[model samples]
Target: MIPPAFDYHAPQTLEEALSLLDEYGDDAKILSGGHSLIPMMKLRLAQPEHIVDINALTELEYIREENGVIYIGGLTREVALEESDIIHARLPLVSEVLPLIADPQVRNLATIGGNLAHGDPGNDHPAVMLALGATIVAQGPEGKRSIHINDFFEDFYMTALEPEEILTEIQIPVPPQGSGGSYKKLERKVGDYAVAGVAAQVTVDGSGACTSAGLALTNVHYIPFKVTDGEDVLVGSKLDKEAIEKAAGIASEQCDPSNDLRGSVEYKRAMVLELTRRALRDAANQARG
Candidate 1:
């Protein structure tokens, strides 16, 4: 269905966008790639009185590495992340997950900032970003501040971003030497949201022990959850099958999965255990090599 009529503004400057938000207040919606917002509006689930388009803000689209951090501009398209050499070299786990999300057509138009800020429980990045411990930078009437990815999602379709705030960048700290990361998800079809998804990053010590680790799961709660209990099981351990099984059990048992059209809570919980095991194993393998 066609979205209801709404005023549109193509603002070239961030200041203009901020002013527009102040002018329209809660009635204004920021438009990024339009991949998620347009569909919601089309279904009448979202009805913004004013749509502030930031497409013309060329300054916000970039991928660059500096000071041992990979800084991705908020407007950077998913296709850009897929093709980015710096991302591939410095952040392969994010790279792996990028193409796994949706399809090339959707990726070409989707932005990382929009994906995380949308606060969809099933979104790929929020879980992965939480695992990677990434930071989201934003601008607002008061100025700028950064938030951890884990803290960004508040509840169903809700986020920590204030109505006056605009997410501007994603910053990932460089992993330690010999670190490896990976993402895995189980979906009913290609390009669909995961029935259960996992992302993990592990760093091994020279003594063949886990030094640091991260684990996150998707589609099991109102927002992504960091599998801290599971990670604790892996870190400082050899990550054998027994260890992985226990870790998976911890995650599966801890997740607050609910019955949904995708699957019964029982089925999703079982899948979570299996997927988390696979993700943890793969991430450990990456770190070992």
Candidate 2:
């Protein structure tokens, strides 16, 4: 299928890209890695009159940790995240999830910013971000503003980013000692979108009592579902089998999924419970060590 005709601009600098966005407004689409936008355009799902390619803006490609937060550039490739020593040492949940995103070929080209900015609920990173309580940084003509992860996703294929804003960075605070995180997804094929997925991060005291917890679901709702109710159940508890079962039950009840090619609503909800329990238990075990 042929996409609608569009003017293309490859900007050498971030400022130039912003200028292009300001000029074109809603008529323009920022081309990050093109894995998401190009397919949408071919199908006529997106028909932007202008394509502002930001791939030339190399400043947006990096991964660095400072203070107590690990900052990842929006343009950083998924392969970099998968291979980064900093990511392996600092963000265990992220390390476990990156390789599961897609095959190596896709990961070599997909940008983290595009994955999130696409606002697709099936993307693995959104659920991970939700479980980690990350922050998103957006740059617009008005300069920069920070948005908490919980506030970032607004609706299906929609986000909090303004029309003229570019997502420039993702910031995640380093988890405290004795904290561990895990992500698990059920897919029919190796690179397929999750039929159901869960990400869990737990901080436990030396005595095995959970002090803090984060749980979120993927491909089970119109947006990534954060399981606050489940988190509340685990906190202050010893995270024994009984408490984990209670939290898993709450997740199964709270998630909203529809019948699809992946499975029936009932089956998806059951997988949600199963995966949530597995992720929570694995995270707790890692935290115990």
Which numbered prediction scores highest in TM-score against the true structure? 2
- Segments in model 1 whose C-alpha atoms lie over 4 Å from true places: none
lDDT of 2 by residue, 1-289 (tens): 8888999999999899999999999999999888889989999999999999998887999999999899999999999899899999999999999989989999998999999999999999999999999999999999999999999999998999988999999999999999999999999999999999999999999888999999999999999899999999999999899989999999999999989999999999999999999999999999998
Steric collisions counted per model: 0, 0
True-structure RMSD, every candidate: 1.1, 0.8
What lDDT is reached at residue 208 by model 2? 86
Task: Kindly report which residue pairs in candidate 2 clash with one another.
Answer: none
> TM-score of every model?
0.97, 0.98
For 1-289, candidate 1 gives per-residue lDDT tens digits of 8999999999989999988887888898999999889999999999999999998887889999899998999999999999999988888789889978899899988999999889888989988888888999999888899998878888888999988889999999988887888888888899998888988888898877988888888889878888898889888888778888988899899988878778999999999988888888888888888
